[model samples]
Target: MQWRGRRQSSNVEDRRGGGGMFGGSGRMGGPMRIPVRGAGGGLGITGIIILLIAAWIFGINPLELLSGGGSLGGGGGQTQSRTVDTKASDEMTQFVSTVLAETEDTWNGIFQAEGQTYKEPRMVLFSRQVQSACGTASSASGPFYCPNDQRVYLDTTFFQQLDQQFGASGDFAQAYVIAHEVGHHVQNLTGILPRFNQMRQSMSPEEANRMSVRVELQADCFAGVWAHFTDQKGLLESGDVEEALNAATQIGDDTLQKRSQGYVVPDSFNHGTSAQRRTWFQRGVQNGRLSDCDTFNNPV
Candidate 1:
């Protein structure tokens, strides 16, 4: 993806070693997991690793995946947190910081063009567990953005799992993950996330899940929007777009569910289907316009 020699963001909060509050007891979960409600949850390192191993050996089971915790969502979660002084992998840290800086550049330009001021969001790099405004999360919780705090929480080890377990690799794929979370931050700044959450509160579970799908798909499109700018700046290589599309396909709710289980349950999907994900992402990449990312008003 040609990310080397790029500017790194200074907003990164590194809490890797064992010096922070949750120090002694928090470094448990290894595989990333994002809770559905972004509330209280805990997965021992042994338990989460077992789940990941089971999925690796068996198949990527969505049911088993959500069984331990839940799907990713936003809200105020009970905060149980800690941090360490140890730095993260130097290479990974540099790569993420670069990505964040690039996104800031892209979004800043976009917002300015729209006659709005862009508020940059911070990214928090943590290891096993860290507390967020949404709640405390383990590595198993996966990477997520907490709108309440306007920060993106990430666990770098998840990149390994993305390659080895999810069959999604490449630097661009990793960037897509970061971009998608940052996309949520964009939504938060634009007041989309808060309004959507308000609407979700009055809907049925199925309805809320559908809304969640649109929200996530929009974030995917936002990632593509960022990709469009990167491509325009000649930063994208030949296969970079494909890497991101493959990642979007692999992480689709239906794809994950089918891999984990033998069948599909449409109702349980919080994220869009594989085709839908790829399509929405392509929409943004093709147009590079925010109007094209209206997953809620237009057909996804």
Candidate 2:
């Protein structure tokens, strides 16, 4: 986690001062929409009927799609605005830039080895709410990667929440979060995410959730792979790997459900269980091989 003095990524875009065009009220009214690639226009009556039929067949709540709530499976809602600490915020920005640069180095080399060009994604730093190609999202949505725009969106305060609320502190844990989203960028480039998005349209909610767990776990593994290479570069400090694993555990769908609702619903799990997440991440750390990070073909 010795990130200071490291090269910072120039791909970062700062959009913190101004509120998004959607406003900074953080109140989400109107119809909810999940930002899927190639998604546009209003749903016609026939489209609604199809969605209803799909929900009926898939055993999912039709309202989730209609209301635009849990269709994509990440938390998002109103978040209160807080005063920013200028010094700390700037430092965190530097830290994030350094981590992103490191990821670029790791993935660039890996892609080159495979004779493919790695397209580095831009990172958007926002406060309160931000607009993405996928749509507008609040800080409560946490850090996310928009396949539509191929950019990683982050609210640096999430790092504070990860430490205080989730009990997953340490710079490495923060790095893991950034790396996981960047991993999605890699998946998007490799056609994995595009294919998944296409196939999920026909899949039931349960099926989609099952597939999502694999996708998320694969990202965790990719983060681990980044860690492995980072460690090789002598950047990892003692307890760094453990910090990343602990972050993975804290954010596992099962763990989050248990913490929020005091119960676990396996069918609704899209991010895998804590053990599954840890196992996949460990696999990546141990092997650092893309072949070993296959979660779809292998049991996760």
Candidate 3:
């Protein structure tokens, strides 16, 4: 987590001011604010998750729900907006950029060793709400990588949610989140995403969710691969690895579901359990090889 004085990534797209024609991002070819209705006729957290995942894996827009002047009816039709103090966010922004740059360095080296070129993906920084090829998303939707857009969308506020809501702390935990998303970018670049999507299309919801768990666990392992490189370069300090493991444990689908719903539903888990996540991540850290990060072929 010793990121100070390190190089920052120029690939960061700052849409915090809501600049550009498409709400905030010039690269996204749509209006800033699009009306969306929550499923079950309620605008709840589940609604945001649906919007996010639809955009993330399927590249489909769920705005059709709003075509009938539908309502996010569970709560009052209120959009959550907060005036961000740019000055206060500068440090966190810098830290994220630095981690991104390091990830680029690590992946670039690994790819080169295999006679391949690594295509560095861009990261979009937004606040409150943002638009992408995936669709518009509220901060509530959390950080996601859209395979179609080849960019990672992050709302910095999620870092706060990680600490206050999930009980995951430390700068290394934040780096783990970014690294996990970048891991998805790696999967996309290597053509894993398209094949996975094709395979998911013919499966039942339960089976598809199981596939998603494998996908997420693989990303967690890839994050550990990046950590392996970071540690080799003496970037990791005391307690850094523990921070990331704590993060993986805290955000397990079973843990989150149990916390929110007061029950666990295994059939609906798209991400692996806490033990699975921690084990797969450790596998990557111990081997530091792409072959070892294959969560699909190997047992979780």
Candidate 4:
């Protein structure tokens, strides 16, 4: 949580205040504003830094971001606008840069130790919705990683939402969110995502959702793996591990369902239960072994 004066990552593609290409970010509770990095004109930064800290960022469609629904309602055009305040804007940008630098250091070392190349994913900061190789997403969609471009898209205010709405506060919790996206990138590197997507071709919706659950849960585990190395390198502080576990518990598909939908549909859960999330995260924290995160072979 003590992040200040650290080197920020240069790979960040800031799109916070660009052309009026997107709309304001909205959620069930209320409308939220986020600090953005300016984008020249493209799907570079993340517009959806909040339905979650998972897979929603990149694969979501553009219409979904603008219209606030799947229909798109016929006015499907891109807009360009700028929305950013100087003071808050500065802080958010700095914080993300520092966090990204940490991720780069940890992941690079991890890949190096394995005799593999560590490709760092660019982090895009955007306001509202932005375009991506994956698709267009609204800030309401939450932070997500785009495997197609190898970048992480985030709406900075989601950090506020994580604390207020999801009850997952603290700096380490935020880092866990980013780490989870990075985890998806890790899965891509290992061919897990492509293989899983391939399996979805012949799968029933329920079965495919099950596979997606495994994929997401393993992402949680991979995030935990990052925490393990971070701790060893003195980047983790006291109570940091618990903060991550708290975050893992907060965003569990079951927990979110109960909070938002008033019921739990086990069949539709993609991110796993809170207990499952915590256990797998702890698995990587303890072992720090990539092999230990074999969620596919194990039962959910």
Candidate 5:
């Protein structure tokens, strides 16, 4: 992504290794689990050597593949986040910050050209748990933007999960995840999120989920908008856009449900189907016009 030595956004707050990430838990059935190794109990040295050899030979991730999946599972997960390796951690943080700075530049210029002020949203990096105006949440919720705080919260680990768990790998895919969450911030700036939240107050569960899907699709379009700016900057190589599109397709509510929970229900879909998600993102990319992102106006 040509991201080395790029300008890093000063808005990042690192909360890794902190304690008590859950101020209020139980959203989406507690913290989401990452695939990792289970206990390899009662294994002899020969067994261990054989396993390690198999891990290397078969391309298994020793972290989870041999032991079990990553965590035994974070419980009562009050912070105490794991510390990231300095070099590896800095690389991701820097990449995210640079991307954020780029978004600020893109949005600021676009807004100024229209005689408006663009508020650059802050991005927060945390671990297992973090508090927000919205409430306490685990990174299991993925990258989310809190409208009340006007900041985007990310657990860099989410990127690792994208490749290891979601089967969506690619720097651009990782970038798309960041861009999608930032898209929600953009929606907040446009008052789209709150309005929808308010409108959903009187809606039935089914209706609310439908509205949520529209909101998600709109965010996808916004990600496309970000891509549009990057495109102008010659930042994208061939298949870069495809990586993002594939990611969008891969993470749809339906797809995620099938992968994580198995099966799908149209009425329960809050993030639209894979096809719908990819389509809206493509709409934004192809048109590169904000007006083209009227996802609510169309019935998908």
Candidate 6:
């Protein structure tokens, strides 16, 4: 990806080596057990059922309730911190910062063209666990963007998992991960996320999951848009685009579910299938237009 010596983002907050208690715990179960690319922590089936009942009785958005009230806090109690190789961690940090800076440049120009101010979101680099406005999350939650705090939380170790576990190895694949989370931040700013959260309050779990697939696919498309511009800047090397496509395919809900459990539940999918993800991403890459990335209004 030729990212070295690039401008690193100032919005990066290094929280590595910081010890914290594991506050929020529960897996949002499906065959896809890895970290998702959106806001909030995992909610088990029990948690979902409880939240749905509570939301129905109180007429509140479940997502808002999941994100606890009050300012964001760091962990309150001590836990054993994960050991990280300092030099390797530093290099990974630089790589993420550079990728983030590139996304900023791409989005800033696009927003300017539309006569809107682009508020760049911060990226929090954590080791084992970190506290967010949504809740406390461990590295197992993967990389997620919390709309409550408008920051993207990432664990560098996930990059290794993407390569070794998912077989989506490449620098561009890593960049796609960061860009996808940042795309969620863009959705937050554009009011798309807020509307989805509000509307999902009344939706059945299946219906909500359907809508979620669209939301996630849109983010994937937005990531592709960023890539289009990045490529225009001559930053993309040979096979870069293919790397991102492979990453998208590797993380598709259907693919993950099949790999993890040897089956698939179409109704349980929040993220799109591999083909859907790749199609939407390619649509964006082909045109670099936000109009082309409309997964909600169009048949995705």
Q: List all candidate RMSDs to the true structure.
A: 12.9, 11.0, 12.1, 11.0, 18.1, 8.9
lDDT of 2: 0.72
lDDT (C-alpha) at residue 95 in model 5: 84
Winning model by lDDT: 6
Question: How well is each residue in 188-274 modelled by candidate 5, as lDDT tens digits?
Answer: 554445445555667788997787777788788878988888888888888888988888877877787777667877887777888
Which segments of candidate 5 are over 4 A away from where they belong?
19-89
lDDT of 6 at 273: 92
Tell me the number of clashing residue pairs for each predicted model. Answer: 16, 0, 1, 21, 20, 1
What is the C-alpha lDDT profile of model 4 across 117-190, one tens digit per residue? 66677777887777665556787678876655566778788888888987887889888888888887666554
lDDT of 3 by residue, 177-251 (tens): 899889877766554454465567678889977887888887888899999989999999999999999888888
Give a tens-digit lDDT track for model 6, residues 41-61.
212342244334434544566
Higher-scoring candidate on TM-score, 1 or 4: 1
Once fitted onto the true fold, the runs of candidate 1 whose alpha carbons sit more than 4 angstroms away are 18-89
The worst-scoring run of ten residues by lDDT in candidate 6 lies at: 25-34
Model 2, TM vs. native = 0.78
Error of 2 at 260 (Å): 0.5
Q: How many backbone clashes are present in model 5?
A: 20
Give me candidate 1's TM-score against the actual structure: 0.78
Over all chains combined, what TM-score does candidate 4 have? 0.76
TM-score of model number 5: 0.77
TM-score of each: 0.78, 0.78, 0.77, 0.76, 0.77, 0.80
Pick by TM-score: 1 or 5, better one: 1
* Clash count, candidate 4: 21
* Top-scoring candidate (TM-score): 6
Off by over 4 Å in 4: 19-89
Q: What ranking of all candidate models by lDDT puts the best one first?
A: 6, 2, 1, 3, 5, 4
Off by over 4 Å in 6: 25-89
Candidates 2 and 4, the one with greater TM-score: 2
| Local distance difference test, each candidate | 0.70, 0.72, 0.69, 0.65, 0.66, 0.73
lDDT of 2 at 249: 86
